[model samples]
Target: MVTTAGSAPTPGTILHLREQGFRVVATDIDPAAPGLYLADRGHLVPRGDSEAFLPRMRALCESEGAVAIVPLVDEELLPVGELDGDGLSVMLPRPGFVASCLDKYVLMRELSAAGIGIPRTWSASDPPPADVVADDASGGFVVKPRSGRGSRGVQLVGALAEVPAAVAASGYRADELIVQERVTGPEFTVSVVVWRDGGVQAVVPKEVLLKRGVTKYAVTRHHAEVERTCRAVQSALRADGPFNVQLCLDAEGRPRVFEINPRFSSTAALTVAAGVDEVAGLLRQAVTDGPRLTDTWREGVTMVRRWTDEFISEEEFASHGLAPAPTVPLVARGDDPAPRPRSTDPASGVAVRAR
Candidate 1:
């Protein structure tokens, strides 16, 4: 089962899982989400934060005989983490780790205490004393919500002096935000898949070339230090499931972890293409006696982004009890072909400009 079928990367996950022979059950608040149509069974459900969400999810799990649930969005992690009991596996980190990852300030402090390299971070309400901040190099600071997802509320101040204006513009209380010294370097998104017995399955690092809120274009790179940093994180946090780590290299080439998402990365498909197949592999491990996954994967794999469409007929929409928007045509146009078949060859469609 996969939640938030409307997200950008979820359709790929659902399709891949279906190909692996598991009956995919998809849920979303929007009836017309493309993934809802792609699944073996699709159900319209309340938003993750709503009071009715978990009860409805439990009902769906019982009815569909789902063995596990993959939550695609951050808001659903804490609530869905509760569903891990009763022979049901929630494909997320443990609940305590999930809670820590959600709060950026707390996460940073914990990692710092564990001797993991991280950006110098502080709560906005209790920023470092003036003397500490006075050494501000030309590089500025990053101001963002203490607990949030993606880049929605993030702001880059020109210098320490501009933090007040950025904070006032955000409309959140000072205590609700955090300030960190901005680090400059090429960024990376790393995937660390762990097993139920606290063993690391694989760690794949992708160097991001472009981005919006997530990695847009990335290429697989073999960085020993990056892998070491991520392994250290796993040892320190002990998140006994899949999680994504976002980090950057400092001037000395040491990895400085900036953020950690206690769930699958948006670039999980890239990990599959790199040959780890984390999503399907982890699902198999959760449900039955699956083979143990190894850390070996193809280096120099690249992932590119493009927009594609999924078509559904008007009758099919009505059959699924979804209301169709007038602006969206259910029938395929002459110029529009069916959604292209996914390439089995890892290097078939995307360019591999690995250096």
Candidate 2:
């Protein structure tokens, strides 16, 4: 049995695991979590601060005869690592490795030292020596939080003078921030699933088509640079579990490491759609007792954001005495037919809008 904690298990992942013939138990601190509704057995626990939660989790695991614990959220990763599983395995990297990857600055430094190509970066707290900053900033620069995720505290600033405010808004002292010389290029994400026995199961590369406030909105598979970069970073990090590495292709099309996520990423859904079952890989690694590597690639897959409406119906609007759907006037008129009101009904279903 595999147990998941924190956020509810993603439906895609849960369904994939079930198809792979594994029983999964999912838990979250919020009982109303949508993911819980689809789980085999969904339960709630006290929020992150509660000490009693670990015992509850342990009891659940014991009762269910759980063979492994899999943490689905960032907050639960470390805590789950620290929990005594009574010899039951937990599907996660070592605690130290997880911690190192959580901090962007540390991960960058390690990757750079390990001979991985990375952009030149400086800590906001250290601010680089005046001479070093001057040398590296020959181009422009980006200021971001040292440990932030989702581009929450990332800013593209043209001059060093803009650094202080960006760092301040990042919720970190100057020393706890990282300022990197902006590497101009197209960005890509490589999602790979690795097993504990030093094997990479799948590599899916995505070209970032649209970024909405740092979150990827549109993406498609077309480039092999992501695979090369993934291989380099995976070797550099020496990570033994599922992880993602973000890279930027420089002017010459060379990939440079930007950051690393040491767990399943928000973009994992895209890879799954591209025919890489990461959850299945995790389950295989957990239940099997041998070294395994998957070198599969699914190219030419595309994913785009969709929008749709729900609740209000066209009939209901007509019944409410609203104007019928507008029609284009066929003959010349003093004024054009009033435009149809935009759909105000709340959207519920997925809408696959073109990028």
Mind sharing the TM-score for model 2?
Answer: 0.75
What TM-score would every model get versus the actual structure? 0.89, 0.75
Q: Across residues 204-307, which tens digit of lDDT does each residue of candidate 2 receive?
A: 77777777643345364656666766876667666777777778877678788888777776567677777676766676657666345455656766666443
| Candidate 1 residue runs with Cα over 4 Å from true position | 129-131, 311-318, 323-355
Report RMSD (Å) for each prediction in the order shown: 9.4, 12.4
| After superposition, candidate 2 runs with Cα above 4 Å error | 1-9, 48-53, 83-87, 129-132, 135-139, 213-225, 289-293, 305-355
Show how many residue pairs clash in every candidate, following the order shown.
0, 6
lDDT of 1: 0.81
Candidate-wise lDDT, in order? 0.81, 0.62
Q: In model 1, what is the error at residue 277, expressed in angstroms?
A: 0.5
Per-residue CA lDDT of candidate 1, range 28-83, in tens? 76554678878887776655765667777888888779899999888788988888
